[model samples]
Target: MNKLWIVLTYAVFTVLLIIPLVKMTTAAFSGGLGALGDALSRPEALHAFMMTALVVVTVTLLNTLLGMMTAVYLVRGNWMSRWLRRLMNSLVDLPYAVSPVIGGLMIVLLLGPGSAAGAFFDHIGFKIVYAFPGMVIATLFVTFPLMVREVMPVLQEIGTQQEEAASTLGAYSWTTFWKVTWPSIRWAVIYGVVLTIARALGEFGAVLVVSGNIINRTQTATTLIYQDVENFNVTSANGAALVLAAFSIGLMLLMEWAKKRRGVH
Candidate 1:
């Protein structure tokens, strides 16, 4: 009896989520393989998917490194890194509180080519806030806190004493990290990276503002899907959306592998 109620609750929630997914897939395959093939082969769709993949890769690298450094500083630094810790931690909450569009707008306010600092960049042939650079920056701003948040708590749980012990034993910085610190935090780092990749690939609002929605150029997969839907090309939109969904699923699988690796170690 109790098991039945629990099953019912989950079944209801599962249906809620699966229904939309079913609709999306239905839209994708309603016209069969021919439509799917056409959507996949479209140059614009291919370009958007490739651009999204590149952004995911870039964001993962940059955020993982910076977030690791930030995590280490928060845990081990001596000179009132506490204040900086507070600041960094506070920014972690921005993704939840601030809208992505607002984040993109903030970037434009500082980096738009029309601004003075932006003029200097323009003079140097570095365009921002309406190009690829701007799109990446916007994605970074929105995805910035994910890696830190994922890893910091794990770092805190591991404590700094292991690092201290390694230092006392004359282990070099890199060696100490690989030997002592990384073992415990590595899974968290991997999870963070996967999450950031997902976020960067799916990031729409922030990129929309900064990318100028430039099709076949600055159009990311998410934005391309948006344009397709808006233009009443539901089939194309679903096809592009499925590509993003596949990307998201791939990262999630990577995260599962990382989790297993963590368990093994």
Candidate 2:
């Protein structure tokens, strides 16, 4: 029965995921390689590609740094109260539960055109909403949990004895972390970063709400696909979608490899 269930689960998964992906890929390549190149060669599409890359890379770096610091504190900070630690843990999962649309809306309400913060920022000649910065923030908020979640378990498993030993041997705090703690958690960090890239690359709802989807300005690859579909440009839409799918598949493969490597080591 368990074997039957496993087969059935694979069937369902393949039907739902693999079939659609195949169809999408077929649609994308329908016009051949030249057509795909043409679709990507357009100025707006090129801009969207660059913008998406920039946003994903920036978010992944920032989140990795911040998430590692937070995870270390949560794991090693004996000074923190139990309640505070629990609160922090809950907050780490907040983005997971909240809809991305709501996350974007929160950013808009807090910093969009008419709000107090918006007005203050406007006076300072900086805009948040309807800009690149807004897109970055929305993507960051939506993908923030991945890094912390990935690193926390590894940290817990490794414990702090190695770190303490390094310290007692006259290593500085930074040296101790680099030589002792980081090696153990490096694979976890890589996995988290891959997940972040995957999430950030495909982010839509939150980024849409905040980015205003300005062509050649704030539009990302996802938004470009959305726009192309709305305009009934199936070829262009499929091309953009195909690019995103390729990105996701590549990153997912990398993530699985990282996971397996982490387990083996």
Candidate 3:
């Protein structure tokens, strides 16, 4: 029965994942390496990739710092009442509950140029919606939960006993975090970072809406693929998608390695 189940699982995996990846690779290289390179080296493609890298770096950094802080607060901070903690926990998962498209629309409505906040920012010579900053914000909204969820469980499992003991021993709060808490949750943070990078890389719906898909301005790699498909440039789209898939696969491998290291520790 176990062997049968394993066979079925492999069948499912091949049908859903392996076949599509194979198809994408074939299509990406159908015109040969020159075609793939030409597609990726186009000015617009280069800009889109650069924009994606920027968003990924910005979103990953902000999410890592903020998500870790939020997770620690939710799990260990004594300032919150039980109900408030519960409320915050629910809010942290709000992104998961909401559609990325809807999340993008919400940002547009709240911060687009027609709105008061948007107008204020615009008046101050800053743009939020339909720009680079908007793209980062949209991506951040979609990926924030990944980091928090990863760290929260580890924090809960490890508990605050060691942190308290460190405090009792005259360690400063930062010292306690570095000395006692960080080692336990560092792996979880790395996992969260990997997840955040993957999600940010592939995020389409939210970034699409918020970015306005402006070429060389707000277009990300995923959005570039969308644009390629819309323009019936299938080969180009495939090349871009293959690049993203490569990154995602690398991240998956990194995650597996991190898991093994974590287990070793």
Candidate 4:
């Protein structure tokens, strides 16, 4: 009976996930590798890849570094009020609850041409909306919570006992962190960063809302795929989508590997 249930679950998962993935894989390779290369080698497609790389790299770096700091503070900082801590914890989940398109709309409201911030940036020769900066901001907003959530649990599990021990032994704050805390949280940080890379790579709705999807300027790979599909360039779209799907799979595998290495269930 147990084996029967396991088999049933596997069959269900295969039907829901494996079938569609196989279909996409077949479509992506329909024209063969050479055709895929040709599609991606186009100038617009290449520029879109470059733009996406820029956004993913920037977002990953900022989120990983800032997220580590935030998790450390949230877990270890002594807050005078419990409500303030609860509020901060809730804010970390904001991106999960808020729609990505709404996130983009919020950015536009804050930085669009009609706003004072937008005017000041324009006067200073900076562009935000419909540009590279806007894409980065959108991606960052959507992916921000991943790192914090991943590292926060690890921080809480490890606790401040070791850090306090190191400080009592006369180690400086930076020394304590480098020698004690970092070793434990490194795996969680790597997991967070891998997830961030995956999320930033495939972001579409938020970026689309702000990017204007200019051909060689602000278009990321996801937007380029959307445009290609709208123009009925299915081959090009498939190629780009295949690349992103491969990236996501690779990052997911990395995350699983990290989890295994850390002996996480």
Task: Please give the clash total of every predicted structure, in order.
Answer: 0, 0, 0, 0
lDDT (Cα, tens digit) per residue for candidate 1, span 167-210: 99999899999999898887788788888888888899999998
Per-residue lDDT of model 2, residues 1-265, tens digit only: 9999999999999999999888888888889989989998999999999999999989999999999999988888889998899899899998999999999999999999889999999899999999888888999999999999999999999998888899899999989888999998998899889889999999999999999899999999999999999999888898898889988988888878777876787
Per-residue CA lDDT of model 3 for 1-265, tens digit only, reads 9999999999999999999999999999999999999999999999999999999999999999999999999988788898999999999999999999999999999999989999999999999999989999999999999999999999999988898899899999999999899999999999999999999999999999999998988889999999899999989999999999999999999999989988888
What ranking of all candidate models by TM-score puts the best one first?
3, 2, 4, 1
Q: Comparing candidate 1 with candidate 4, which one achieves the higher TM-score?
A: 4
* Model 4 agreement with the true structure over 46-134: per-residue lDDT tens digits: 99999999999999999999889888878887863667777888898899999999999999999989899999998898999998899
What is residue 233's positional error in candidate 2, in angstroms? 1.1
| Lowest summed lDDT window (length 10), candidate 3 | 73-82
Error of 3 at 160 (Å): 1.7
Better of 1 and 2 by TM-score: 2
Q: What TM-score does each of the candidates earn? A: 0.92, 0.94, 0.97, 0.93
Q: Which pairs of residues collide in candidate 3?
A: none
Q: Cα deviation of 11 in candidate 4 (Å)? A: 4.3
For each candidate in the order shown, give its overall lDDT on alpha carbons. 0.84, 0.92, 0.95, 0.91
lDDT of 3 at 101: 100
